[model samples]
Target: MMNNATVFTEFSLSGLKDITTKNRVILFSLTLLCYSVILLVNVALIMTIILDEKLHKPMYIFLCNLCINSLYGTAAFYPKFLFDILSDTHVISYIGCLLQVFIIYSYASCDFSVLTVMAYDRYVAICRPLEYHSVMTRHRVAFLVGFSRLVPLLCQAIVVTMTSKLTLCGSQIEKLYCDNWSILKLSCNSTTANNIVGFIVIFFYLGHNLFTMCSYVQLVKCALQSREGRKKFLQTCVPHLLCLLNATVALLFDLMYARYGSASVTQSVKNFMAVQFLMIPPILNPVVYGLKLTQVRYSLLNLCRCNKQVKGLN
Candidate 1:
């Protein structure tokens, strides 16, 4: 007799495994509200950047990219997630799982990449003020944006492609959303290539963060000597650091939890760990940048004031 290996065409998400109907309804409402806020704030910030001609600099440009990418990343998780919150079955087709893995993972990798570019922009603005305009010209800004997006996307495409080739034996993913590590764990085949590439991607992730940290160190050294430098550092660099820390910490939590979290951990904790990166950063980044960056803050306020005045006049 020949033994046939079990194959799975779909996966069950056990993150919502034990919730009652009342809890599910409450969770769905809360999730919808969160997603709504995320869309509203990010969209507002993006429009504030686009409409105000004065805000059309490298810094604002990159910040806009950050907000847009936040939406991109969250879209991967939120719609499907909201549906799953109400759903009793909590199932996803294999292809759907792969799509989620690609979008969410690429979003994370790209966030780091954009932050690194933004860090370089700040360094040049503060440290090499004389050449700031020359260095971060329109062409260069465009190139940096493309580089930040393309490299991460390309890397994630490779990872997700590798994942799609695997023959999964188990059909249950323990976490809230589709994750590469969870899928990899399900594979009966050797994950040597996936691990190697995943580590390389992680190394590059760390590389982006390390580069940003070093740049900020140099920035702090430069800012101490001058009042204007200190102002710029406070106004701009501080928010960037907040965003960096927020996204990095959130992503690290998810990554660590996905690969090494104890199965005995409570499902609620697992859900939080799984979704923090997706939930927090998308909403947080735009709000932080909007409040902390003066130009954007003023523009947003004016935009709101103008809208109210128009309403009154109408």
Candidate 2:
């Protein structure tokens, strides 16, 4: 008899079961629409920031990095998801599964890290206006941005590395995409080390959230001191808070789905729970920034106007 627990070459994803061709077509169209919006807005914001010299400040720099990461994260999931929708098999190669886990998790981790850095940037600008330029120099901003991207990636690298060593007895993932927790569930070996490290990474980033929220609280308190501070907070700090809340809720949903979601729950809810992090934040962040942030909004408008003028000249 063949070994049932032998190393599997591929894993089947099981979320799209029992769907008809019509429904699959509808799902593909909607996913493509959403992914297109994600690309358009994120790329628009990223290009706006890159092209506009005046938007090169620390805050916008961080925001540009956020959009860039959104693109990176969504690219990992959406392309494969669309392909799976068109095919009979919802399976991923072992290496591809690990790579997806790394990109998706690291993307989530990178969001928090970027937000934490943005909070610090807001703190300096609002709490210490006089020292803003001196403190948030280009060099400092580059280092902070580098810090935000590097830490989560390295941390996720460790997690993915740990996950790759597991002796998986089964290969069917209960969710739509490959994730570390789901992969961990397949492992016949003990996951104590993986759990410890995963917890450490979770708490470490949760600390980032705590620091960011406390910073927001202090910012609000400072904003209440005067009218001008209040305006600045409304303009800048509020959007960051909204984004934080969005990210927190999405992350929490995924965490719950990964741990507590059951077959008893409807698949629609399960799909939403698994992918809220991927779906909502990428769209919301750029929209919020583009609409709310004066510089970005004006820059986008100017970009559009310039494109029109060039077209007219042609």
Give each model's whole-structure lDDT: 0.92, 0.93
Candidate 1: worst-modelled 10 consecutive residues by lDDT: 1-10
What's the count of clashing pairs in each model shown? 0, 0
Q: Write the per-residue lDDT of candidate 2 for residues 1-314, one digit (tens) a residue.
A: 12456778999999888668999999999999999999999999999999999998899999999999999999999999999989988999999999999999999999999999999999998888899999999899999999999999999999999899888889999888999999998888889999999999999999999999899888888888989999999999888989999998899889867977777888888888999999999999999999999989999999999999999999
Off by over 4 Å in 1: 1-7
Question: Model 1 shows how many backbone clashes?
Answer: 0
lDDT by residue for model 1 over 156-182, one digit each (tens)? 999999998887778989878899999
Candidate 1 has what TM-score? 0.97
Off by over 4 Å in 2: 1-4
